[model samples]
Target: MSLVNLEAVHKRFGEFEVLSNINLSVSEGEIVAIIGRSGSGKSTLLRCINGLEPVQQGRITVDGTEVTAANADLNNLRQRVGMVFQSYNLFPHLSVERNVTLALKVVRKTPYAEARDIAHEVITKVGLADKFGAYPDELSGGQQQRVAIARSLAMGPKVMLFDEITSALDPELVGEVLRVLEALAADGMTMLLVTHEMKFAKTVGNRTVFMHEGRIHEEGDSRETLEHPRTPELTGFLDAVLH
Candidate 1:
């Protein structure tokens, strides 16, 4: 079975449908990149997969558990599915180490020393080992975002969801965050990223999904899908983004 699965998913906000008949599957260690224009439901779909947003119809399963089920263990699901957003969302008052250790101590009830060790390990993984003592304000936008990613990694999630994670970074700093993601991909992390970085999506992603108007308009091998888009919508999108 796929590590993450969505079947005929439908979601709406009040009367406006944001997702329609969406079906997708992500296998273990696969990196799938989701691409689309604003309002195309990319972020919404990511939210639904992690159970941050409830779907009105269809099912979502992660690691063999149905996320849409009434009795779903959302806490457990969240522990296994980590999500990082465009915004860093780090705690300004806390040091980077504390920020990463907070959830481990609180939600997971890990002891302080162990949590600290975990934080150090993940911080190192994100290339921020020396910044552990720094506060959010002391770091650059890219560094703060890496801290956020480290915080999620400390949870040891099975799958990571990235919703335009580099969107908020400056052009010069964007490469740093993307490098961290590339490292994670190289380590065989299962990831689904909604990204505007066409180059990364094409090269690093195993599969690329093009969403259009709340639907999966096209999907295929990442290089093929980006280099030779099968649909006009995808072709136009590639043209607009690539050129």
Candidate 2:
């Protein structure tokens, strides 16, 4: 069974439909890259999967839980599906360790010592072991973003959702964050990312999804779809991004 599934999903805001008849699935340990122009519903789709946004129609299931069901445990769902946005969203007043462990301590009721250990583990995973005692303001944009990723990973999520996580970084700092994501993929962590980093998408993604006008325009093997786009929409998009 698919680890993540979206069947005939539709989303709208004030009569302006944002996602239309979207159907997608993601397998465990698969990395699926979602690429599209702004307002193409890429981020919205990720939010829906994490249960941050409610759909107007259809069903979404992640890790066998029906995310769209009225009685669904959103908190539990969110814990299982982690999301990282372009903005780091770290607590400026808290130390990196505290920021990463807050959710575990508060939400999961994990003891302080246990949460701290988990924080340290995830921080090391993201190459920020030494920065655990540092404040968010003391870190660079890339370092802060890595902390944000560590915060999510500390939850031990079954799947991760990344929404343009590198868009806010300086070009020089982008590599560090992407390298962390690369390592996660290498570890067989299931991930779905909406990104503009075409090269990373091609290299790290097992499958590529091209969304256009709120719909999936094309999808297939990442290298094949990205290198040889079959549809005019995808071809045009690649041309615009590649050059």
Worst 10-residue stretch by lDDT in candidate 1?
Answer: 234-243
For candidate 2, the lDDT comes to 0.95
The candidate that achieves the highest lDDT relative to the unseen native structure: 1
Candidate 2: residue 64 lDDT (0-100): 88
Clash totals for all models, in order? 0, 0
Cα deviation at 197, candidate 1, in Å, is: 0.2
**Clash list (residue pairs), candidate 2:** none
Candidate 1: residue 26 Cα off by (Å)? 0.3
Off by over 4 Å in 2: none
TM-score of each: 0.98, 0.98
Candidate 2 local Cα displacement, residue 234, angstroms: 1.1
lDDT of 1 at 93: 91
lDDT per residue as tens, model 2, 123-235: 99999999989999999999999999999999999999999999999999999999999999999999999999999999999999999988999999999999999999898
